[model samples]
Target chain A: RAHSNPFSDHQLEYPEKPADMDWSKLYPYYYDENTKEMTKKVTITDIGCGFGGLLIDLSPEFPNDLILGMEIRVQVTNYVEDRIIALRTNNVETKGYQNINVLRGNAMKFLPNFFEKGQLSKMFFCFPDPHFKQRKHKARIITNTLLSEYAYVLKEGGIIYTITDVEDLHIWMAKHLEEHPLFERLDETWESNDKCVQIMRHATEEGKKVERKKGDKFVACFKRLPTPEII
Target chain B: MSLIHPIQDIVSSEDGSLIFGIIKNEVVVFRVEEGKSQLVGKWVDELDRNEVIREKVEKEQARQIAENITKKRKTNDESAKTIESENKTAKIPTPGLGAPTVYSHLRNVTLSHGEKLLIICADSDKSVIIFDIDNDNKENVLQLKKRQPYPKRPNAIAISDDDKLIVIADKFGDVYTMSVDSDVKKIDGNVEPVLGHVSMLTSIVVVKDSENKKYIITADRDEHIKVTHYPQTYIVKHWLFGHNEFISSLSVPQWNKTNDLLLSAGGDRYLYLWNWGKNELLSKFNYEKLIDKYITDAHLASERFQNEENNLREYCVSKIVSLPSNRLVAFFVEATPLLIILKYSPEDNTLKLFQTMEFAFNIITMNVNNNQLLITLDNHESQNKDFIKILDFNENTDRFSTNESLSNNLDTTIASTLIEDKTSHIGSTGIYPLYTTINLKKHGESYS
Candidate 1:
């Protein structure tokens, strides 16, 4: 299945996974019990994953899970590919350099196209670009319209994790999630219990950057509510 | 067997030993160990619902009668003399008379300095109130004025360094500006044009250049840092683009011996340092670099290796600030609150991170004065109240330590340093004291 791609643009540019490529070694923190087995069978997609850090980080955590990072930038995708090779982690993979990938696409638009209803178990928007101004509000990654798409892709009780340093953005994200009928804010107990917070803080590239600056990081988790039972 | 607990409205004391408040308008207390509730004290006749409603109706009738009498009195001088006495008996719920309602859920705050006054932007009432902080009677000086309300909830506010203008940025991306001293009477002259941006303006800093020119440095949701110069106000002088996410906060160090440095933090978890004076980019660092440096260089060889891999690494930079001794501190939110202390060696264009400190929580805002470093943490853990930790830095020995608790939980996620006292404080001075006066009215409940 990896080789029959004559018409596909998804060919690896650098045929050789570089000697320095060692994804398993780079993100050993992700290689815990919970992730190791899940990765084997689960299909993970990272949305707006800049440089595929989360995917790279998760690869080790869930080494068997087929993880994919979707980014809009061709250069960023290439960089992640190089990073993946340098890290030399198997099972972690990438799609072609399309404008939209399972992870990198304008999720608001292509999410429903690629993912069937309740197809994804977890979706991560780590440090997504927040378009702040009133005029630019439409350009924000999370909106009333986009939340519906998230609802469509996410499975019942699926979770979405967001981390941002901007206080305003944090509140904005929370407001939207709280208002969304399909989602509910993760309870304090759940947030503390989940290993994703640790993964987000230490595994993803952005999480580490936040640690370096001592910048206040705002993290919000939302669970996709199960569809209401019919009367 | 399935056990179902009834949904109960239970209000407990801070210590959780005694139950407080009335249950269904009746004085009642709950016995926790017994898992039962019981009526406590008898309700006073005046406090009873029927008597209270009757009193309210009587007050309303009396107010109406007084209003009628006053109207008739105004029409005739003879009647006015009689109605003056009657009007004095009517007690109305006049505005700004009793204790002002307090708003508890304060999400964000901003300080705008005018010619002589400081304007406080708070989210609770969705109003901009002015305060004379320097006045002897600072407590009672906060006067709420009605300017144009924000189109949406405001997220941040910035006053030009000169203290002449104020800018309010909302969650929906509207930037409203008004003069600091503008009141109800001067509102027309105070209102300014809205500055349009591509995304919501998360944070703003009003900086002055070496030429004494003012520039509005704004970070927007679109991950763009805009340097808009004043006087012209037409063209954006330059746009700093690096972060692929939302810019959360902007910090401009006070005029230092070397030059003024502008630091920006964003959702991308990166801190960027820009020299606004030179209109040039300075340094960008992220958590990836920090962890990589630590994990790979546990033997201390990572620095030498990082020097080689610097060109290849993608780093997230969250915040930057100027330290006391011509150095800059960048804060990253990745692992711990890592403070990367950088010293500028003019010999090389690079800013070196000489020392680093680990903090407990993600730092949202930091203020450095003298040798004191005041850091505000983003309240990620709901269990912990948002707080500002003060750290004192010694340039001679190159050590940093906490001084005192400056302020705690001024806002929901982050706290800003409003005033810092530089004379006595070893690090930052004039820390903005938290104002806890706003009283929010309860619905048919006691004000307390």
Candidate 2:
């Protein structure tokens, strides 16, 4: 359950394009049947969201914005989905947990297929698969090429939040994001005051496990820079 | 049904007179003017013909062998490098163990804007070799201009409108742009990657918009068509995501004068049309029913790729060529003898099937030579002289038809033409596998 190969030929379902994606089923509270459109689109994403901890915590904070979690593991995604459903069911009168939902997907490969260009305001990488082996470094969630895609889906000034307990993977992720032309690493000051970063610090199940183990947590946040104009 | 010393791939001049054919590791030049097609001259891969290159290859191979850290492991083909970036440059053993007999088969060729230089990709070395096409000379026609090597072999290439920049998308998912006008003397080392996909880049096209703003549109094996701002490739404009399978071909029809409409097809059920600049899927034309019969056993994934449930019969749109005059585009699926032609309707922003032209033999490759469609057929079986046919547009019939008498003259000229057969080292199979686009599919490997 801890290991899911990103490159595996898993038959994950995805819409052909962002326009074709019907988010109403996932967040029925936001759907407007008359206009046949959702009142709000998913702006905050928790990629590789193992459980629903981050999604649940962020849902109350960004109530105006729709929050979605994408997990590759079938059992983990189902657990999160059921968790969200139970929360929404309990608070049926107020419809409290309707903003957060989890979908099973290989986010590394299908990010653009689900989100449009500059569609996301914030993307959370909450203790993603470190893929520690030197040879499997490319399989890491934050890579140069994959960062380009992340930059594509993220709006200008949008932040990418990455937290990992693995020292080597944290450096690897930070180095790739720093080296990329479209992303500029945020300082400690920016990380401290950012509400989403604070939520992610204590939110993910992995972060909680690391806390229980007394392991060091490394957090790196990068802001998407505006694409430079063609000369 | 493998090609045994045929014109593996080809390109022609703007005037349609000069033809540069890839015969194994050789580039053969033929002038088709008047009623006769005369073989001019040819340039073989220098590693075999020239002493200088052979020595260099030997030295390079020795250095690579010495640089190797681990004990030698056998490699099947070029995909080994793509699988892992580690230097897999094995030592050159005779046609024996640990040593690789260089094939250097010429492929993915195109001419300059003025049709002056023959730009081609060599499969063996992952190098882009340029040749000067001499219009005046009769004997020495294809003069080697430059041979620039890269970390990974280029899968697709595109030239800028002014023919100044050569954009190369290597199989490792990296795209790099090199100045074509500059001297390419520094052909040995790594060229900085400009932009890339996380997946294998299958095809690329450099097109200009209404305001003459250039964009590099690239298709990858992961069913993605990315349009990025040229030169400033850091600016990814948009991704046209429609196909569920590997997108192998991208075409901006010359007939689409507005230059916004894009034609894309690959390992999908339909050919996709996109108003790329606006990030809109204009329409998609279904080809599954049409190509159902042509999908043969060869289209099936090999035993390595087969799942326990079934052997997937997969095929990709290998090549797409748009006619210059009419809003007509012709494309052929991998290893299929049929060419499906379509007409793009600007009014509806949709593509309609116009014709499905079938041949006696499967098509090896195709190129649009100034409104004339030149197709190289897989005629290796009978050693048929009608290996290459130039189909011309018939205005009255509103279709492209092959002229028999003209083709006869070409067949006659081709029979007399000769290029040194350099494929003896490759053993029984004459050339490397002609169709590899199908292999791009990842059929769920058990890594656990």
Pick the TM-score winner. Answer: 2
Candidate 1: which stretches are off by over 4 Å?
A1-231, B1-118, B138-148, B184-192, B255-261, B276-279, B291-319, B334-337, B360-365, B376-388, B404-448
- Output the lDDT of residue B354, model 2: 93
Q: Cα lDDT of all candidates, in order?
A: 0.51, 0.80
Backbone clash pairs for candidate 2 read: B92-B99, B93-B99
Residue runs of model 2 more than 4 Å from their true location after superposition: A32-37, A82-96, A130-137, A165-172, A179-181, A209-215, A227-231, B1-4, B46-104, B136-138, B181-192, B288-316, B353-356, B395-398, B419-427, B441-448
lDDT of 2 by residue, B1-448 (tens): 2223656788877667887778677777788878578888777665642343555577776665544422233534554444446555444434556664455678888998878778999876678888787878867777887888776779899988787779999876778888775675443332336787767789999988999888899998778899988766777888887788888788888877789888888878788888999988889998888988999887777877666866678787888888887789999988998998999887898889998889878888888877588888777665536668888888899888987776777766766555224341233645556786777775643432
Error of 1 at A23 (Å): 34
Global fold similarity of model 2 (TM-score): 0.83
Quality class of the docking in candidate 2, CAPRI style: acceptable
- Model 2, C-alpha of B3: deviation from truth (Å): 8.9
RMSD (CA, Å), each prediction: 24.8, 6.8
User: Quality of candidate 1's docking, in CAPRI categories?
Assistant: incorrect
